[model samples]
Target: MRRSLAALAALLVAFSALTVGRADAADAVITDFGVQAGESDRVQTVALQRAIDETSAGGGGRLTVPEGEFRTGALDLKAGVELHLAEGAVLLGSDDIADFPIRQTRIEGKVQPWVPAVLNAKGLSGVRVTGPGTLDGDGKPYWTAFWKRRAENRKCTNLEVHRPRLMYFESCDDVEVIDLNLRNSGFWNLHVYKCAGVRIEGVSIRAPHGDPPRITGDDQPWDEVSIDRAPSSDGIDVDSCQSVVIRDCVISVGDDCIALKGTKGPRAMEDEASPPVENILIEGCDFQSGHGVMTCGSEATIVRNVVVRDCKVGPGVPVCRLKLRPDTPQRYENLLFDGLTLDGAQSLFDVKPWRQFYDPQGMAPPKSEVRNVVLRNITGSLRSLGDLRGNRGDSIENVTLSNIELITDRGDLRVGEVVGLRYVGVVINGDEIEAPDSE
Candidate 1:
C-alpha cells in the first residue's frame, strides 16, 4: 500500500509539471525592445507590438509592461503569454480611429464587420492580463463624434455609431484578468465573446460618471445632461460564453454593469448553431451606477445556470433585469439571485419584453421563454418591486421568491402572463405578502 501511494504522488507531480511546462517557456521583458516612455514620435505602438510578437515567437513567456504611460492601438495577445502591467503603469488608448483596424468580430450578439478593440485576443489558450495599473481608453473624441451623429439623427441605433471597445477576447480559453482598472472606454469596456473558463476578479471598470465634458470641436455643451452621453458603454458583456466567474469587481458605467447575450439576427441564427451561455457566476461585486447589476439578454438564444449573489448595488440601479426582445428568439432559465443588498434601487426585479431597435424584417416576431428563477434572502430599499410582463404569445414560468424584506412606498408588483409563482415570507412596507393575491 505504501508503494502504491508513492506511485500516485509521483504521477500527480508529473501531471503538474506537464501543465506548467505547457505555459511558461521563459520570462521575457518588454524593455528589451527600447519601449521607453516620453518618445517624441509616439512609436510606442510599434515597439509594443514587436515585443509581443518577439515574445510569442521565442516560445511564450511573460511580457511585463513597466511603470510608464504606454499609448498604443490594437495589440493582439497570444497564447501562453501573460501581459503583466506593473504598478504606476498606464496603457493609454490612441484617440485616432485609424489605430483600431476594422475586423470581422462579434458585436451585440451578431458577427459583423467592426473595428477591433484596443486590446484583442482571439483563439488563444492560457492568456492572462494581470495588472496593478490602469487601461485608459481616450474616449473623448469618440464620445464627441457619437453625440454629433445623434444630433443629426435623433433615432439612431447603437450600431449606427461606430466605436471600438476597450478590451475584447474572442474564443479564448482559460483566461484571467485580475486587479486592473479599466476606465473611459469608447464603447463596451470588456467584452468576452465565444470564450470559456474566463475569470475576471478584483477589477474596476468605469466610464465617465456624469455629463461629458465640452470639447473644442463639438458645438453643443453637454452640461447638466441627465442622460448618459457615453451610449452603450457597458461595464462587461459576456456574449455566448460559458464557465465564466466574475467576482470582487467594482463596476460603474453608463450602461448595464454586466450583461449576457447570445447570437442575434435571423441570418446568424439560421446559419450557425452557436452554443448557449451557461454556468456563469457573479458574486462579491460592488455596483456603483449602471442600468442593472445583472442583466440577461436582449439578444440571447439560451442562457442558463446563472447566479448573482453577495453583491451590493448602489442607488438608482435595478438589482436584476431580464430583457426579452420580441424579434430575437431566446430562452432564459435556471437563474438565481440571493444575498443581495440594495440601497435605494429603482426596482428589485424587472422582467419584460424589450422593444428597442426591434426589426422583424417582414417576419413574425419570435417568442421567448423565461423560467425557473429563484430570488431569496434579498434585503433592499427600492422604489418598486418591478414587473414581469411577457410578450403576447410568451409567458414566465416557475418563479419563486422567499425571505425578501424591502422598504418601498409603492410595492407595485406587476405580474402579467406568469405561471407557477410562489412567494414565501415576503415583506414589503411592513406587510407580509404570503401569496400572490395578497399584493
Candidate 2:
C-alpha cells in the first residue's frame, strides 16, 4: 500500500522536527542582548533587567518581546521566566504609580494588601505569557486614583484602591496565558492568586465599553460618569486559586467576564474551610466585555467543579451571573453552563443576594450558598428586561434546564424558587418549560 503511505508520511515529518527543536530549546532570545526598539526607558529598563537577570542566572528561558513599543518601569517576573510578546509587540506602561511599589501580596485572597504590579511575578514555576502582543496598563493615572478612593470610601476593599494589576501571578505553578491582547488597566485584567495549574488560552481582553472609566473632576455630569466600576476592574479575577482553565477567550471589560472570588471580610470562613476552589473550567468563550460570562459570589470562597460550555455572548452585558453575597460564608456547588449563545443581552438568569454592596458596619451577615447549578444547551435571542432573582434566606439550588431555546424581550422565565428549579427540553416562547417530576 505505497509503502504504508510512505511510512506514515515520514512519521509526520519526524514529529514536526522534534516539535520545532523543543520550542527552540525552551527559548530565550531577548532581542540578542536586549533593549532595542526606540530605546532608553532607562536603557530599556536596564536592558530588560539584564535579560531577566541573565535568564534567571542561567536556568530558565523565553523572554523574547520583539516588535515595537516597549516602554517600561515595573516588571519583575522571574523564577524560570517566560514573557513572549512578538507580532507587533507593545508591553508599554510606566505612567508612574511610583513605578508600582508597596507589596505584601495577595489582594482579593486575603493576605493583607498588595500593589506592586505592572507585571509582577512571584514563586513562578514554568510561567508563560504568550504572543499576539499588547499588555498595556498605561492606566489613566491608575483610573484616576481609583475613583479618588471611591470618592472616599464606598466600603473600600480591593486593597484600598492602590492600583496596578494587568497581570500579577504569585505562588505560581504551571501557569500559561496564551495568545495575548490585554488593554487599558489599572486593576484586574488578570490576577491569579495562590495559583495552580492554570491556563487562560486564546485571550483578547479590551476595556471600556459603554461608559465605565471616567471619574473626571466630578461636578455631576453624573459625577463625571465614573462607569469604569473601579472595584475589581475584572475580566478575570479567580482568587483563592485552584486548577483553573479559561478557554477560547474574547472578553470585553468594564467588570466581570469571569469572577469567582474568595478570602476577605471577617476571615471568609477560615478562607472557605481551607483552600477550596475546585476544578474550574470555562469553554469556548466570547463575551464582549463586562458582567457575567461565568460568575459566582461577589467574593466567592468555596466553589466547586465549575464548567461553562461553548459560549458566545454579546450586546449590552449582564447575563448569567450568580453573585450571592449576603455577608460571606460562601459555597457554590458544582456549577455548569452548557452550550450557550446569546446575542443582545440585558438579562438572563441573574441570581442576586449581593447585600447591596455589603458594609453592615464592616460586614458579617452572609451565610452564602448556591447549590448544584446546571443550565444546559441555552440559545438566546434576548434584548432586555430579565431577572431570575433568588434570596429568601438563600437557595438557588440544583438548577437543571436542558435544550433551552429562549427568544426574549423579557418573558419565558423568572423564578427564585421552584424548589431550586429544573426543566428538560425547555423551549420558551415556543412554549415548553416544564420540570417538576420530583424537585
Candidate 3:
C-alpha cells in the first residue's frame, strides 16, 4: 500500500523527491508461432525459443506471450528482444532439471558450469522482460530434493543441487524487467550478475516463508507436512552490478528480500570476474517478510553507495542487515536508509560477523570495515534497535542515527568496536537519547 490517500500524497511527494520506463518492446505473439496453450512438451520449448531467436534476428522486437499456461525449459534471451507476458499469461518452468542446460555461469560467488536460468540473458546490451502476468518457477520438486540432500549432508551448498532460477542476467547492460510477478523460485527469484544500467520496477516477488507446510516426496497432502524454509530462495540477488535502480517492488520470500553480493575471500580482490556492487537505489518498495529488508554480503568484498528509502516493511524484516564475513575481506560503506515505515522486526540494524562455514583456505581472518552509514527519518516498532558488533581488528566507523523514533520491545541496543557513532534527534519510546556533542 502507498498508505491512506493523505499519507499517500505525502508519500508520493517523498517518493518523487527520493529519486530513482518500458518501450514498445510486444509486437508478436507466441501463440501465433503455433504454440498451443497449456502445453508442456518440447514443442513448446522449441516454439518459444524459435520465436525469440527469429525476433532477435529480425533486428529486435517484443515477443508477446498471450494468455495461457506455457511450460518450457531454459530459454536464452538474446539481444534486442523482449519477452512480454500478457495480462493472464504464465511462463512456467519445467520440473525436469535436464531441461535446463548446464553452462559456465555465475552462481553465488563463483562462476562455474551450472544450469542456465529459466530465462537467461548474457553478453547482450539491451535485455527486457515485462509482464502484468506471471513467471512461475514451479519449484516444489526442487525444494523437496534440496531439503532431502541437506538432511544427508550438513555441508551442502545452494548450487550442489540442480536448481534453476526464474530469471538471470549476466554480463549484460541496459536491462529492464518491469511489473512481473515472479514466484516460487527454485533458487533466487531474479539474479543480476556483473551487469550495469539495470532497472527492476513494480515487481512482486514471493516464495514461502517460515515453517510453512510443504508436500513431501511421498506425494503427501499440501497441508500435512511442514518444512523449515524454502532453502535459498532469495528474492533478488544483485551480484557485482552497478548503476541499478529497483523501485516500487513488493517482495516476500524465504531468504533475503534484496541482497547485495560479490565474490568472497582474499582471492576475490584480484579476481576480475566479480566486481564490487555499487551505485544502487531502492525506493518505494514493500518488503512483507524475509530475512532482511536489504542485506549486504554473505559473500562480498566491497559493496558501496546504496540508498534504500521510502519503503514500507512488515514484520520479520530487518531494516538493514550486514553479514560481515570473517573469512572474506569485506568493505561496506556509504549506505543510507531513510524515510521508512515499519511495523515490527527483530532488529532495525543487524550487523554481525557471519561465521557459518568459515573456510578461508589457510588464510587468516582478513580485516573488514563498515563505515560511513546513516539511518534517519524512520518511524518503526521493533524488538530491538540492533546488535552492531564488528570483529576484533575490524572497524565499524562513522554511523549516524537521526530522527529515528522507534518503540523497541527487546533489550538495549548493543554496540562495540564502533567509532564516531553519532545520534541526532533520536527518540525511543518517550525518551530522547541525544548526544551532548552532535555532528
The lDDT per prediction is 0.80, 0.70, 0.82
Deviation of model 1 at 270, angstroms: 3.6
TM-score of 2: 0.33
Q: Worst lDDT window (10 residues) for model 2?
A: 14-23
Put down candidate 3 lDDT per residue, 19-127, tens digits, no spaces: 2244554488887777787665443678889888888888778889988789988999977888899998989999889889888988879988999889998899878
Off by over 4 Å in 1: 1-25, 40-43, 211-228, 266-273, 435-439
Better of 1 and 3 by lDDT: 3
In model 3, state the lDDT of residue 127: 83
Candidate 2 lDDT by residue in tens digits, 385-430: 2555555566555666778887776554556553556678877668
**lDDT computed for candidate 3:** 0.82
Residue 194 in model 3: lDDT? 94
Better of 2 and 3 by TM-score: 3
Clashes of each: 0, 11, 1
Q: After superposition, how far is residue 29 of candidate 1 from its true place, in Å?
A: 3.2
